[model samples]
Target: MPSTDRRHDIDALRALAFALLILYHVGMYYVAAWPWHLKSAHPASWLQWPMLALNIWRMDLVFLLSGVAFALLARRAPPLRLLGRRAWRLLVPLVFGMWVVVAWQAYAEAVTRGAVAPGPGAFVLRYWAMGPWPEGAFSGSAFGITWNHLWYLPYLFAYTAAMCLLLPLWRHPAGQRLRAACCALRGWWMLLLPALPLAAYGLLLAPRFPATHDLLHDGYLHPLYFTVFAYGFLLGTDAGAWAELMRLRRRALVLALVALAAYMAARSLAPDWSEARQALRALYAWSALAAILGFGHRWLNRPWPWLAWANESVYPWYVLHQTLIVATAFMLAPLHLGPAAEPLLLLAATLLGCWLLTDGLIRRVPWLRPLFGLKFRRPATATPAPVRPAAEPIPR
Candidate 1:
């Protein structure tokens, strides 16, 4: 149960993912009117590139990283303790974040418009009532701030809880038997064990049960997300195999890109061919999973101190960045900053500001470090990678 070297590369990747999130949101605000927001006479056409580049893949990458992190947790702690930690890590933020941070966001807009702001309880009610659709709750409109982006915390916690429940099986002779069953299926095709169920649910049950990140639309997305999270956990635990895949980095990148391209094309055309889209989406997720492994294999072990620091800051940055993006946009909006310069500057400002602000608070208030998964730094200390013993390949 002793900690091994910290995976600074993976931390860099996490920071990378959240950085993409920041860019995406900032890009959307300037160019495309969100699904909820009304379309303007002049849309920021420049957004298509960033959107295409990151949109389809970021969530999957985050989940994959979550799985890797989970594997780490499993290695060090028992299920009960790990589950408790996950809840603390997620729920505390969800409750306090929504009630305090999101509330402030809502009030700022409300006061600016001379509208009545709701009390905290009413704020929760208003947010909870909308149900998860992009429109109002379940509809796919993106006009209003749902204040629900933090949904990942809760969704991930649910997935982690389910995986923990399965941990006993995952740890035992029976689990070995199940993995054997999975292994017997075939190369890469074994992904169907998790993917098919999710695909089925997304295709069949998603309409009725529906998986949504929205505050209001809660049907079945959590279970599916959890299922894939579990799969990633299992796959990533085999460090040697992961390392081997890392060595095949080029091959993995090619396969991942090919699958991702196919998936994107299908999504673009899916309005005409739904079935083809579904099939490709499943294929894309599976291929992406492998790509993640391959890529992680190549880079997850490298030590970069900045990545270690950025990784520690990713969660807090994520929590704070969206609001910052909105505020920065609004402030810049008044200056009539030329459209081209607007998004780029805003994105840069947001990243720098978030990093500086979070870093300052963490240093000034040592006790709050755990809230952001940061450790207080001593002048001469370098972060050792969080690794596992040779006997325990699974780290989470």
Candidate 2:
């Protein structure tokens, strides 16, 4: 494939990844042992099994896809220009999301925990002012504010800016050589070598720092995410690498499953066996990603009718989904809906809210676009086709 050609597979993978994230957040509500902003009336311990499988690799896949998106965009614009655009697209939504889009989530959590009385008016006033409220008021109450799920935006923006700053080195001969070596890996090297660094991070940093998701304090995640992000940029347009991934899809899937089983077994059999489990976790993470990308390339690389709409709507939906999930759960809590009816209604309501608010309101309003990480509409005008074709559109 040409460097400029649209990678429909990547687009589909990214959309599917975000969709999985939404589902995972919904699962968070009902997972008995895990902590979320809010919980369902009926938390299922069995959820831990499936949630563990997904939790290992889901965000890594998302970050890698983001790196791929960055590589695609970098081809079209100068580093400085790209940096400016990324900052606008990421930061604007982050600020807006923290203050406005995520306000309901924080409020719901506080009310549910008895941290605050239920009053949207008063809560909004206090939240907007960045309250120094009673301890345990919300997730990030210690910092006087919280971004919740919107943490991804700022982290992505930081990574983008860092990559942009490093563009000069990335374009240099040494960088190209490094990129070439990464893309040239084959078979077992491709499968296992990429995971060593992840294992190292898990063993070295995770014990001390943990995943706080507070940006500045996230020692382990910064390295892990940045490394995978760099991996995506290196392999994004490499046809040979993608071909290898597709060829290895089945083997990778098998390996991922085996790794997951081993990791879980180790945890159950010997809870203190940290080193082996971490290695297994890293192995599972990379293998699962490879299988996902490979299968996506083979099957999802198409221009489906709904893809265009999905591509555009995904950002707003991501911003809106968790809030809807939280608020819906809160509203339904009073009625004492059973587990079966409650989660079903929560899922339906969340999806409906995302559709109604995003398509019905946000997309139509010009001013609201940037606040949700969408581009402003350009006036329709005739223009000549350029020598280089536009790249595939990836979710921000």
lDDT of 1 by residue, 1-396 (tens): 114556655566777778878777766665564452212224766666557656655677788778878987788898999999888878876766665455445544443344434354654455445322222321222433344467788778878888889888877998887755653444445434446765675676556864457734666666556666766686555655455455555655566577667766766766776666665666556555666656755656576657656766787788788767765665665576666677678778888878787877754576665555455454456789977778987746
Off by over 4 Å in 2: 1-4, 378-396
Alpha-carbon TM-score of each model against the true structure: 0.77, 0.94
Index of the highest-TM-score prediction: 2
Candidate 2 TM-score versus the reference:
0.94
How high is the lDDT of residue 208 in model 1? Answer: 82
- 1-396: candidate 2 lDDT, tens digit per residue: 334388888888888899999899999999997988998889999999999999999999999999999999999999999999999999999999998989999999999999999899999999999997799998998777799999998899999999999989989999889889999999989999999999999999989988989899999999999999998999887889999999999999999999999999999998999999999999999999999988988888878677888888999999999999999998999999888998888888988899999899888888898899889974467989655546856458
lDDT of 1: 0.63
What value does the lDDT take at residue 62 in candidate 1? 83
